[model samples]
Structures are given as structure tokens and as C-alpha cells.
Target: MGKTPAELSIPAASISTEIPDIPVSIPSQLLERRPDIAVAERQVAAANAQIGIAKAAYFPTVNLSATNGFQTGTLSNLFTTAARYWALGPAAFALPLFDAGARGAQMAASIDAFDASVAAYRQTVLTGFQEVEDQLAALRILEQETEIQNKAVALAQEALKLTSNQFQAGTIGYLEVMTAQVVALDNQKAAIALLGQRLDASVLLIKALGGGWQASEIPNRDKIGGKTKWSQFLPIPIR
Candidate 1:
């Protein structure tokens, strides 16, 4: 049997349903590649190194010394007994007995610096998450808005055409036609502006994520625990 027109013709409504899904995961992927996070991590590591240096001050300084030499003097002692001298002993040991709390203060300062680095790391991580979330939400909302605006533009254009035809036929006044044209133009301009906004938003998101955007490419979201591990070493949140 041959197909009827109803079966052969594609439905206009189905066109919308056929639209491909947007690549919304780009931002997420960018976030995973963010270099700022790495920089922050390095800062934390540097802070830790400083703390180690400070802590080392609490240990006593140990030194070993050794001296060996052949003594040559006047003819009387030149080769008389083959003069030789050798000495080996612990050179010196100095422990900070009392520095008016200087050593302790230095150690405390190192600790404080480390704590600050930890807090900074946490802030960076939190800011990253927030940026990703905000961009994702904006993208989602804009997608819907764009779809609706597109439909509105189409309807406005159609209305303008109908109104123009009516005015030419003397069924409507010129004012009505002008109003319709203005409405259609406004709708079209709004849609264009919205498209530009979407593009800008995408760019901002890409920047925030740290480039090479791809949301689905992001590592397992579960891996990002709410608490940053660096914070564990700090006694207080760094200002």
C-alpha cells in the first residue's frame, strides 16, 4: 500500500523535538582543568615547607670537626720526630636555651602562614564550585528563554504579515500595520540580543572553568568533597 500525505509529510511540531541537545558540560570540564586550583595547591605546599623549616629550629644543631696537618718548623724540629698533628671531635652543639620566645614566635608565625594558605585554598575551591554552578544554572535558564523567544519572534513576524495584508485591503488602519511591524522588529531585535547574551555567557563560563570547556568531561563530581584537605593542617581559618 502507498503512504498517504498525512504519513508522508513531516510534522512541523516534530522539528522542535528533533533539535539536538546543547553541549552544556563544557563549563564543567573547564573547571576540572582550572590552573588556579593547582596554583593554590602549590601555595599550600610552600606553606607546609615553611612550617617544616620553622619546626627544625626546635632541634639542636650538631656539627662534627676534624683537623690533620704536618707541622714543619725550624731545622731543629723539621724532621726530628716527623711532627704530625691530628684532632677529631664534636665541633659544637647549640640549643636555643632562651631567645625571649623568638624561636617560638617564629614557629607560630610559620604555623599561621600555613593556616592562611589552607584557607586560601579552600576559598579557591569554593569559588570554583560556585562559578560552575552559577554558569550552569544560567545556561539552563537561557536555553529555555531562547527557545521561547524564538517562538515569539516567529509569531510576531506572522502577525505583522497578516496586519500588513489587512491594512492594504483597507480592513485595518495604517497605525495598526505600523504597530505590528514595530512589534515584529522589536521581537527580532530582542532575539538577536538574547543570542549575543548567550554567547557572552558561554564565554564567561569557559573562562571561569579555565578553558577547553566540556561539562561531561569533568571528573567524577563525587570526588570533590565539601571540605578541602588542606584545611586539616590549620588551627584557624586563614584570613
Candidate 2:
């Protein structure tokens, strides 16, 4: 974009003025392709993991140790109590019997965090659907407007043709022919601008559809030491 005209070297490309044919209804699962939804889903997972970690604090901790040594390398001496000594015992044990409800409070807070993440994920999904709907509606309306503009352009061109013929016949002045030509040109320009709007709307619709991203690209929770139902984590499926 910053290059000089000589260095630009733009490629040859065809421009399409036709409007795209889009369905009235799209699959809800297509929203899974949205990156925001994916991020929110992962946040929910992380919060769920945090809940488990917090609950672990209520459990006890145990430690064990063992030691064995021989005064002599001889097999006979190894069997003798005077030549060998060994010990095995529980090194430490702790049970959180009383923490003034601190462990309970932590567990509750973690659960609340998980709930919040789930809510956030749902909201993100809703926003994605809204964006898609907005673009689709825009395309539909623009298509209709472009169709009407095309008719106006055709009518203006016909009028300009008639005026030109009258001018050549000397029945109408050149000024009359020029006025008709201006009107035709204006209509043509309006039609082109409408086509541009339709193209813009089409691009926005594709972007709302996640730019071809697939739900399969999302990370699997099963491989991360957990088996969460798809409905529990993401209520929608990848279509």
C-alpha cells in the first residue's frame, strides 16, 4: 500500500457486481468458529480446574520414609541384627480439622468463579450470533436496494437515448440531450455505489462466519485429564 505506482505491480482481477445468494437461516453451530467463544470456553475450563484445586485443600497430607543399612557386605552379616539396622515410619501427617471455615470459603469462591465463566461464555456466543444476523440482514436489504437501482439506471439510459435521437433530428436542442446524459450518468453511478455496498456487506457476513475457522480446531478437554460433556462446556456443536 505504501509502494510507488511503479513498484505496486497490482495483479489482474475481475470485479463482481452481482449480489450473493445467502440462506435465510444459518446453522447455530457455525458460531463455534468464533475465536471469542473459543476463548470463553477455555476460561470456563480453567475455572472448573480451579474449583478442584481449591477443594483439595480440605484433604489431609501424608508423608512416608524408609531407611536400611548394613555394617558388613557379607550375606551372613546382613541377616544379623548387630550388623544391620532398618526403619520405616510415617514422617508427617496433617488433617485440616479447623481453619475457621477458610477452606469452605475458598471452595465456594471457586465455584462462583466457574459459574461466572460459564455465563461469560454464553454471552459471547449470543454476541456472535447477533453479529452474524446483523450482517445477513444488511446483505438482504442491500440486495433489494441494488435491484431497484438497476431498474432506475435502465430507465435513465432509455431516456438519454430518446433525447439524443431527438437532438439529431433537430427537434430538441443540445442542452436537452446533455441534461438527459447527466441524469443517465448519475443513475449509473448510483447503481455502481449500491453494488459496492452489497460487496461490503458480503465481506462482513463472511467475517461474521469466522473466516472459515472450524470447531475441530478447539482444544480437547479429554486429553487434558478431564472428560467434560460438550453440552456442559459449549452448548453448541461445531457444524
Candidate 3:
């Protein structure tokens, strides 16, 4: 049976808890998810695998081959040990000293793929930043709006109650009471809708940031810069 997503995932305990928790300054918790980070990481691994495949093309391939044959003038000779001849030897080596740009094409393709992956990773990071910023801004605005709406609802509800009492006292008609009630309901609904929007925006921001991929866990710039060959294959900027 195949491993489930949770089973296949890196253990949470292996990750450092030194990374700070996401702050709840804004209503959205979306950036905390970091879905894009995980995607970029996977892309980096795939690009590295591709690079390995490309590098293999530059190395000489060696193979061992063996053969056993039996020649018999009679059916009885087929089962005789003397009738069998066995041979074993290293197979031929056809090293590609040069191809009509085949190796060059492969190298170029691999490099291009690496470059593309880097770009994609950068874009994902930028997108994450943008989402967080936008969501934070939206959250702030929505919070303010919600507060205003709540006040409006409260005021409308008080007005409706007052109008109701006045109608019962025969100082106002039923229509006035109905109008106030409708206004209060509308304000309450608007507040609820704004609250929902804030929640949605938070979720979106979390997804953009690459859910659970903590920025603090990223290796230092110096360490990333020191790496020569394999590290270059990483999709995201290791720093």
C-alpha cells in the first residue's frame, strides 16, 4: 500500500520550533499555510533530478553481460556438462566524445529548466508577499467596516425598538416600525458578510505563503552562497 500524505510528509518534530508563530495582527491566517513554498520546494527537487539525468549523459556507461550456449549433435548431449559453453565479459563502451549538439542541447535544456524553476520560485515568493500585504490591508479595512456596521446595527435596532414602542402608543404607524426593523436587519447582515470576507481573505493569504513553510527555517544567505553545484539546482533562493 502507498503511504498517505501525512505518512509521506516530513515529521513536524524534525522541524525547529525556533521559527516564530505567525502574528495575528490581521484577520487573515492564510500566509501561515505557505502552500507556494512547498510547491517551490518540490520543483527544486524535480529540477535537481533532471540535472542528475542530464549529468549522466556526460559519463561513460559500463555494463556486464553473460551468455551460456549448448551445442548438441544428439538430444542426450543437451543435458551433458561437456556440451555447454559459457562466456562472460564487460560489454562495449560507446562514450560520446561529441554529438551534433545533442549533449549541448541537453545541458542547455537542463539549465533552462533550472532557470525557469528559479523564476517560478521567485514569483511564488513575491506572490506570497503580495497576498499577505493585501490581506492584511483588507482585514484592517474590513475590521473597521465591521465595527462601523455593528454601531449602525445597534443604532438601527434602538431606533426600531423606539419606533415600535411609539407605534404601540399610537404616536407612530406600523410602517415606521417596519422600516426601522428592515434597516437594522440590513446592517446586521452587512456586518456578518464583512466578517466572512475577512475570514476568506485570511485563508487565501495562508495558502499563498506556502502553508507551513516557515521563512525562519530557510538557511542563511552565507550557507546558500557557499554551495556550488547541487545547490544551484534549487528552485527557491536558498537564502
Candidate 4:
């Protein structure tokens, strides 16, 4: 750690100095917190919608037509009641039966895709939970270790002070004083490193919690398709 310029530094930010406990409903609540999980879930939704779209092809296509116009022997009489005429009709067809096999294949592919997405969503959830657990455990252990290191630094400083006093009094050799000084310096440096580890663990824990994102913040799957406006469908708070 001493030889490394790569450091973790977060200004004006801190969490509890102790390890955090996992929520009671980690499995259920994790879905809303993790953006990765949300992405996988949305993919599943999109794939499901594709299945519906593929199935809709099996239904007959209905076409409706209407025409209304006025015709007269002369332009002056074009708007007359005798020239008024209107016609309307409905038409439908399901004649392309040969394409049924292709449609079926497409539907099956969509279903396979949905299944894959679902599997991915579940994997994301599991990974999210594991990361949270890992960071929490690391944070807890680091907190305890930091406290121990602080005590060690304090004790080493006291020892160094005593050694210096003995050296000044000619009761101990200079080598003893140097040893005590080195021990104190190393312990102090290790304490600083422990503090840094705790800070880094906090950052990882925050990421595992999805950076304060909520499931409710996710947009409705329907609004994400076709001509739907994103802002109208998904309201996200800035900042």
C-alpha cells in the first residue's frame, strides 16, 4: 500500500464506522436496488413482449375501408343532396398458411429468449447478493482490524517514548531506541492503511446497494417500446 499511488478517496462522505447488517428481505429487495438486475429484468420483459408479438401473427388480419364523396353532372351541383354517396366495408384474410411453420419457429425462438433472460436475471440477483455479503463481511472485519491497529499504534508510541527516555538516561543502547522508533512508524502506517481499506469497502458496499436506485424508479416496460416518449413514460429524478 505504501508504494501505490492508486488510492481510494471520497471527500465529505462516510457511512457507519461499523459493518452493516444485511436487510431482512435481501432477495426481494435486491431487485429494486441493483441496476444490473433491473437491466436483466427489463430484458426479460422485452423478450416476453416479443413472444406476444410473434403469437399475434397467427390471428387473421382485418382490413376496413370507407369512401365518401359527392358527384354531380356539373361542378355547381357537386354539393347537392342527390350527389351525396358513401360506402364502407370490412375485409379479413388468413390465407398464408404456408408461413405457419416459420411463425411457429419465431415464437419458439422468442420463448427461448425469454427463458434465457429470466435465467440471467436470476443470476444477476444471486451475484448482487453475494457482492453485498462479501463487502459487508470485509467492512466488518476491517472495522475491527482498524480498531486493533489503532491500539497497536498507541502502544508502540508509548514503547518508543519509554525507549527514548531510557536512552537519554544512558540505561539503554541507541539500537533499542531505533528499533522502537521503527516499530512505531510501521504500526502508524498500517493503521492508515486499515482506514483506507474501510473506505474502499464502503464504496463497494454502496455499489452493491445499487447506488441508492429503487425498483420504482425503473420505467414501465410498455413505455420503452415504439413511439413512446421516455420522459412521459419514465419519470426520473435528476440529482
Best by TM-score: 4
Tens-place lDDT per residue, model 4, 59-160, is 877777899999888999899999999998766555456764899899999999999999998898889888888987897798789889989989999999
lDDT of 1: 0.76
| Prediction 3 TM-score vs. true | 0.57
Task: State the weakest 10-residue window (summed lDDT) of model 3.
Answer: 12-21
Instruction: Point out the higher-scoring one by lDDT: 2 or 4.
Output: 2
List the candidate numbers ranked by TM-score, top first.
Answer: 4, 2, 1, 3
- Tens-digit lDDT track of model 2 for 136-170: 78877887887898899899999999999999999
- Cα RMSD to native, each candidate? 12.4, 9.1, 16.1, 8.5
My TM-score estimates for the predictions, one after another, are 0.67, 0.72, 0.57, 0.73
Candidate 1's displacement at residue 90, Å, is 7.2
Off by over 4 Å in 3: 1-40, 71-74, 80-84, 132-140, 170-179, 202-239
lDDT of 3 at 160: 90
Tens digit of per-residue lDDT, candidate 1, span 75-147: 6675555777878985898887878998889999999999999999889989998887787787778779989
lDDT for model 4, please: 0.77
lDDT of 3 by residue, 1-239 (tens): 49885577653342122212356543333342455555675687678678889988988987779999997899988978989998998687768887898987898898889889988977877777787778668767877887888899889989998999999999988899889978987987787787678778667655555453345544443433344566566967554
Where does candidate 4 have its weakest 10-residue lDDT segment?
Answer: 19-28
Global lDDT of each candidate: 0.76, 0.80, 0.71, 0.77
**Could you tell me how far off, in angstroms, the CA of residue 2 lies in candidate 4 after the best superposition?**
26
Steric clash pairs (candidate 1): 25-214, 25-215, 26-213, 26-214, 26-215, 30-209
